[model samples]
Target: MDIPYTSKPRPDTGLYNAKVGIWLFLASEVMLFGALFSSYILLRVGALEENWPHGLLNIPIGTFNTAVLIISSVTVVMAWASLKMKQFGRFKIFQAITVLCALAFLGIKSFEYKDKFTHYEVWKTDGTRMTGHIEGNPMFLTKAKLVAAGKDKIEFLADPHHYSEGKLKIGAQSGEHKHVEIAIGDIKRLSAFVPAHSTYFAIYFTLTALHALHVLGGAIVIGFLFGPGSKMWHTDPDRFTNRVEVAGLFWHFVDLVWIFLFPVLYLL
Candidate 1:
């Protein structure tokens, strides 16, 4: 006679747990980024005594990148829909498009970084070393000239009278005596300085770099699903579809982070 055997029930991932887990993870990420951004706000605001670095950021390039990420998010949804409908061919097409969009986002980001480097706007934490004088942009000279020619707003905002005292102090200390000539057009070129080896620059670099890493990770996952080693999952469309859904969740998270970051870094 043989004894009957019973198998134990597997643990269930309840609907609440699935949703809560994602939210909890996002909350933690928010806290992490919140700390970084708060530090940035404190340091920059304190240093400038009220001014912030919004003018230094390239709004147009950032806006274009924002659009790219938004479009990529849409393509990701399309890819998921294709998988759900069991249209593997169309799913692949959408997946590829999403990857391309991610690549384009990185390309645009590269250009922005290049612009920063070229302008010598990059900073270090140390006080002794810094690149890029605030006067490099000719637009500021033009604005100064305009202000001198009786531009009321310019005279009000960056009045040579006010800046002269501060400029002389800086010049005397640094032994860099430069005359205060308020060129009418130079006001446009005026940008807040990034201190050498400053924590603000570190935070900026780290946050953006981490976001880019997420995009790279998403691209790798997508590639693996369609690459040679995908045979195991390919044979089982249901399982493969679930995998795509999970990947889509991660991609959406990356996009969501950028949504918040765009306003904090570029807009604010």
Candidate 2:
């Protein structure tokens, strides 16, 4: 039997089957992200003010990713609009641009993740926490070494913000940051600012990684619609157009999620 409303809208709903399906799927997605946002808020509010880390994430990089996503959202709409105008070549061009933006966003995100993994945080015996890029593997001053000499410190550049004095205020802040030698015995523990490092990092990794997966999924669907799926444009033009609309809707949702994510994770 032929399925109805693949392209044609149902009389009562005024929407094709594919469009309805997409909306239902999008509703569930809304709930999924809503829960994550709620969790983030609760976590942020409950945490101690001084204990929570801020300004650790790179804002410039986050801003760049936001721009990429915003542009892709526009291009995806244009691609779908091109189909409505029966401009096949224009649709292909816009769709390709959308996919390229996705790649760029993912590339920038990967770089951000790499920086977090390489950055280190050290806690001293006196309860002072120092965070920065490591100079070398933190030396483990064994009990024997600690007793042999009072040299018990891990060497690392103090995180730029840790010392708010005149020194950090005026500086190039590239490969050259304030370096300090901490005795190993004085060091309680040290590790990179990874997911396991703290609650903030754990949640940061979880939320961003999930969003990245969504971007990848959306890119694959868009790429397919731009290439192999375009064949349907010839054989069944209406059905193909409906598919494009549905995919565009999903893409917009993905972009919206990032808009929320950038501020909560990066800016605030």
Best by TM-score: 2
What TM-score do all the candidates reach, one by one?
0.63, 0.87
lDDT of each: 0.60, 0.82
Cα lDDT of model 2 by residue, 78-102, tens digit: 9989999999999999999999999
Instruction: Give stretches of model 1 more than 4 Å off.
Output: 1-11, 15-28, 44-51, 121-199
Tens-place lDDT per residue, model 1, 1-268, is 8221111112573333334455677778778877876776776667663223334456778889999889988988888788778787887788888888888988888776655543322122332222243344322233335356775332222222222134343323444433333333333333232232245546666788789888888888876766653464556665566566666777888898889888777755
Q: Model 2: clashing residue pairs?
A: 152-183, 152-184, 152-185, 153-182, 153-183, 153-184, 154-182
Cα miss at 13, model 1 (Å)? 3.0
Clashes of 2: 7
**Can you give the lDDT of residue 51 in candidate 2?**
65
